[model samples]
Target: MKLNSPSRIHMGLIDLNGELGRVDGGVGVALDYPNFQIEGKESSEIEIDFRIEIDEKDKENLESRIKNAAKNVLDIIGETGISLKVNDAILSHSGLGSGTQVSLSTGKITSLVYGIDLNAETLAKITGRGGTSGIGVAAFETGGFIVDGGHTFGEGKDKIDFRPSSASKDVKPSPVLFRHDFDWDIVLTIPKGEQVCGDREVDIFRKFCPVPTEDVQKICRLVLMKMMPAVIEKDFDSFGKVVNELQNLGFKRAEVGLQKESLKGLLSKLQEVSYSGISSFGPTIYSLGDKDTITEISNEFFDKFGIEGEIISTKANNSGYEIIK
Candidate 1:
């Protein structure tokens, strides 16, 4: 089986207080381009190969994840294995939720090849993908604009702690709060910039958690009132304005502060012509505007920096992954 999974941008984290016994909330959009392509077939044991150039560490990590996912499946049914290859994958750890997409894709294809009848959520449970943001899993199952209610935070199983999504341990996936078909073009920019990963990301969470209640409230209002309404009416201007403002508030504020000074300046420069914001940590900027104008701006950005960068101009995906035999 072959599968194509859309990439997702985490627009922003809605709430982090958890003081009101509510979990973190977030909004995201699925992109039609920069998808991860995977192919799989039954095998005696789990195996994986990436058709793209990736570091040895990434390759080893992928192999381990695939083996673990397959092992979980084996525990469920009888013994089984599969051979899988990531033919094409969106840039990993550049704020594109690459780990979740890659893990879910591998799990889905392995299940399909073994006739395990697994769904996206179950696949995530076994593969440990959606610990915090369900946007990626939801996008895999059915692509669109997605809002996740986040995990519960009260006591016992419901209780949660402040941490990066990847570091949160033994947590179930967050629930999808809202979803709708999104019709908009997104210009994804991945210039060479400082990437937040591993210890750096965890440190950020440690420093910035329990974000001001006021800021979280503003984000919730913008998302619930402005963002959702704009999308329903296909109002790009309103949507862009809301998304652009998100960076100055909530946890995003701290995230932006952690990036290099040059990247911060670059993002500010691009905002003049487009509704732009940095996706996930540093470096990958998301811009919304007309295709031609977006292309020109992206080209100009590369020219100005004189460094090779990727500008993926794509539409918002309306549907989920396509599984082909």
Candidate 2:
């Protein structure tokens, strides 16, 4: 079986304050490009191959993720033997939901090889994903614009404190509150830099969380009253306004504050020309606007700053992943 999964932009985390009995609510969009495509077959032993060009460091990390996920699924199914060939790759830790996409794709492929059916959430649980944010998991299951209601908070609840997905293992994915078709042109900029993860990510969550309640309220209001309506109505301007405003609102503000000077400058440059913001713990900045204008602005910014990265002009993937048997 061959499977392809869409990559996603984690617009922002909402309600990190967790005063309202929930935490880590999220808003995001799924993209059509920078996806993962892999083919899996029943085999005598677990094996993984990458057909795409990638450096040794990235290849080793990618292989580890795939092997770990496959092993987890193999244990569950009481079966052996799955061979996976990665035909395409998503850059890891670039704020493109690459880890979740890679893990879920690996788990899904492994389960299918043994004829064990599972949804993304179940696969997520088995693979130890979707603990903090559901945006990535939701994007894999059903693409387009998505909002998740977040996990229950407090002692003995889904979580007791603020943490990133990698640290919040065993917690289930948050509930998706709203989903709608998003057909806007998007320009994705993946600037080369140190990506935040592991202890640093956990420290950020620990330090700034329970973000200001007012900011959380503002984000909720924007998502509910402005952003959702804008997407449903295809009001690019309204949606773009929310996108730009989110950068300074709540946890997003902190995320942006931690970016390197170069990345921060690039985001500022893009926002001047289009509605732009960082995606998750990013180096991947996304802008919503005329593809040509955003592309030109990004190129100019790169040229001026001598930054190295990739620019992808793509659209929302409303239909999610596809599988060919």
Candidate 3:
């Protein structure tokens, strides 16, 4: 059996730091690019192929990771009796929702092959893929501008609780086309290396965060007043400014090194020519603009920095993941 699943890039809007107990949630404007394809069986041997525009030596490592994910999925399905194969996943991970995308794509494939009728949300919860931000999984299942209320523990396993806050709780997961009109062209600058955010780091950062209730309230205000409005109005200037400001504020409050050296260098270069914002965690930076502006900035950055990156031009993907068979 063979299956193909599309990939998406998260154009971050608001950072949900104070609102969510775990990692800060960002309102994601999804893009259409990079798709995943799964081939072979669900029994003994599994093969994964990650298809991307860039060519590099990292394919070997990606293959290993994909195979492991597939194995895990099979175990979760309680079907180690069957073998599975996943192929042609994407390279963008750790920074953007790469892991989530891969996991969702794999889960979708497994469900299809096994005749299990699990929806994207269910699959996401079962696989523990979208623990922090459910938007990634929602985007994978259904693309567009998404605001995931975040996650909550459920009684036993059948019933899952989503979105503790009323604002996010009321907003269901679906495609936002007309209302949230965002012109989405993003420049993704990922520094070559690995930086993982473990539980200990999260714990330390949370412990050190300011206890004053008012301070946390202020951060939430910035997200609602500054970030949300910018995205809704499709105002790039306001959006970029707010993102930069919010990121700085979050980093300061957390007192953690949010931007690494390579990412900082890339940001400096982009700032000289264009407006850009850092994605969740560190390393992967995104610059928003139209097609021409994005292309120009991407070329300029490559010429100056000689960095391995991608210039993806796409609008808000109001249409979520579609199965092409």
Candidate 4:
């Protein structure tokens, strides 16, 4: 049997440095991409196929991670009888949510093959893929401009409370735009290298972050009041400014090695040319501008850097993913 799934790009609005007792929140938008397909299914065994390009170092770990995630999905849905052969790749990493997309596609295929009644939120939890940044899971479950409520954080003893209490509960994600007629284009610049945000980095950054209660409250207020509303209105200028400011502030509080150097340089250049905002974690820099501007800027950046990267332009997918059989 063969199955098909949809893929998406994540618009980096906020950084994820402060998600779980760290510093602030990571805000992002989900851009729908025309990539995703799952083929071959059987009662005893299944084969998964997907195409995505990322840094070579992450390839091995990514493959294993996805396979485990797929197995987790099957186990959570009570379909442990099936064995999976997952063949996955990352087409674009820095800007697109390739990792999350792969897990979602895998989970969706497993549900279809096994006859499971898992909803979007339930599936997201089962996969254990999109809790830190829910935008990726939102895009996989429902493609479009999604504003996730973000995860809660706690101290050492309170860590257990942070886990999702009800995995099966439906989370109605807010749509950034209602009509979906916004004219926008994104140019993703991923430096040719591997940038890892592992457990060590997270711990180091968390240790350095300020512990004042007022600071966290202020960041939350800005996210709810200023950032979210601007995105809903499709005001690119205000949105870009607020997002950049938020990331810059968070970066200051973060440790020195949290973000990669190449990503920082690319972001500097993109900001000079007036794109939108940069990616949160590592080397993926997303520049948002009109078609003409995006094209011209992308060409100039590629020519100057002399590196091979992907440049894709797409609109907000308000309609989400559809089954085309």
Candidate 5:
């Protein structure tokens, strides 16, 4: 079986403040470009290969995620052999939610090879993903603009502390509160910058959260009042305004504040043309508006700043992943 899954832009996490009894809510959209593509077949033993050329470090990371996911499925189903190959992949830690896409894709293919059916959320739990935000998992499942309800907070609940997904593995995916087809042009600008991960990412969550209650409330109001309505009505103007506003609110503000000055400048330049914000952590910035204008501005920014980066102009993937036999 061959599978193609969409990559997602994690706009921001909402409600990092646990005072309301729930935390880690998220909002994001699924993109059609920069996808995860893999092919799997039953084998005598587990094996993984890559069709596309990738750096050794990236290759190792992809292999580790694929192997771990396959092992999880094997251990659960008492089935042990599958050969998987990565035909395509998105950059890791580029804030594109590539990790979740990689894991879920591998798990889904392994499950199918063993004749076991599993949805993305089930595969995520089994493979230990979707702990902090459901945006990536939901993007893989349904593909659209998605809002996750987050986890119950406090002692003896889904989560008691603020942590990234890698640190909160046992928690299941948060429930999706709303989903709608997002029909706006999206531009992804991934500049060469610090890719925050491992201990640093965890520490950031600890240090900067729980975010201020006022900021979380502002984000909630923006998402509920402006963003949701814009998505449903296909009002690009309102949606773009909210996207721009989110960069300076709640946990997202902290995430953006950590970026290098060059990246910050780049984001500011893009925003002058359209609504722009960093996707998840740092590096991969997304903008919504006319693709030509955004792409042009991105190139100009890179040229003027002497920064190496990638820019992809794409749109929403409302249908999620596709499977082929």
Candidate 6:
């Protein structure tokens, strides 16, 4: 079987003050490139192979995710083993939500191999993802501009709680509050810098979470009044304005402030000409508006810094993931 999953860019985190009993609301969009692609078939025992070009250190991590997903499915279905291979992969921990895409893709592939058809939500839960944000899972299932309502905050210890997806043990993927066929060209700027992931990500969350209530309110207004209507009406100017400000509120504000100085300067420069924002705990900056303008600025940035990056212009994926037999 063959499988292809879209890469996700977390546009912004809406609310972090879940201590007040609301889930962590977030927004993001799916990208068409730098995707997780896998082609695998049944084998005697469970194993995974990778066609890697970016880095070799990722080999073990890639293998482990696939192995863990296979184990979870086998435990439930009573299957002895299965084989898998990753023909391609997304960049890990670049604030692209690579982990979720890879994990869910592996689960989807394995379940098909074992004759168990699982939904993206099930794949997400069983593989231990989508705890905090559903955009990644929903984007993988169906490529679009998506906003998730977030998980519910309940009373019981075992009930839903506000926590990072990585920390949460088991939880249902958040429901999609809204989804739309986003019609706009996007410019991606990936700079050479540190990525927020693993323990470092957890630390950042611990320190900056319970983000200010005022910022969260601003984000809600932008999403509800400005962002949604702009996309619906195909008004790029209004859309770009909201997209530019998405990182100004909640946890994403901290993410932008915490960027490396050079990256910060680069983002500032891009903002001068384009409506832009950082994606999640990003080193990947995405800009909307005139594609040509963003590309020109990004090119000049790379030339001046002498830094190499895989910067490209792409569009939104309007459909869901594909599974080919």
User: Could you give candidate 5's per-residue lDDT for residues 200-288 as a string of tens digits?
Assistant: 99999999999999999999999999999998888888988998999999999999999988788878988888899999996899988
| Rank by lDDT (best first) | 5, 2, 6, 1, 3, 4
- Which portions of model 5 miss their true places by more than 4 Å? none
Per-residue lDDT of candidate 6, residues 1-325 (tens digit): 9898888788887778665566676788898887888876777678777676657666777777778887887777777677776888877767788889888888888778877889898888788988888899999988899988876676763235345777874877888989999888888888765777777777888888778888888888999899888888998999888877776778888899998877888888888888888888888999876877888888888888887776878888778678877
Cα lDDT, all candidates: 0.80, 0.91, 0.53, 0.52, 0.91, 0.81
lDDT of 3 by residue, 199-228 (tens): 544554446442344554555676577667
Global CA lDDT computed for model 6: 0.81
TM-score of 6: 0.95
Model 6 Cα shift for residue 245 (angstroms): 1.4
Report the error of model 6 at residue 172, Å.
Answer: 1.9
What's the distance in Å from true for residue 324, model 5?
1.4
Clashing pairs in 5: none
Give each model a TM-score: 0.94, 0.98, 0.70, 0.73, 0.98, 0.95
**Residue 299 shift from truth in candidate 1, angstroms:** 3.6
Per-prediction count of colliding residue pairs? 0, 0, 16, 8, 0, 0
The alpha-carbon lDDT assigned to residue 12 of candidate 4 equals: 32
| lDDT for each residue of candidate 1 in 3-65, tens digit (9 for 90 to 100) | 999998988887777877776667899888899899998788777777888768767776676
Write one digit per residue (lDDT tens) for candidate 4, span 1-325: 3433444444332333344453223455555454445443545543333354544666676666557666877677775534444343445344456666666666776777666646556666666555445666666665555555544345642122222211212322222222223345555555565543455435544465433455455556666676667666877777667655554444433421355555466566667656545454445566665556655766666677676655666555555444444
**Candidate 1: segments with Cα more than 4 A from true spot:** none
* Residue-level lDDT tens digits of model 2 in 80-192: 77999999989988999999999999998888877888899998998889998898899999998999999999998999999999998899999999999898888898888
| Candidate 2 wrong stretches, greater than 4 Å | none
TM-score of 4: 0.73
Worst 10-residue lDDT window for candidate 3 reads 163-172
Winning model by lDDT: 5
When 2 and 3 are scored with TM-score, the better candidate is 2
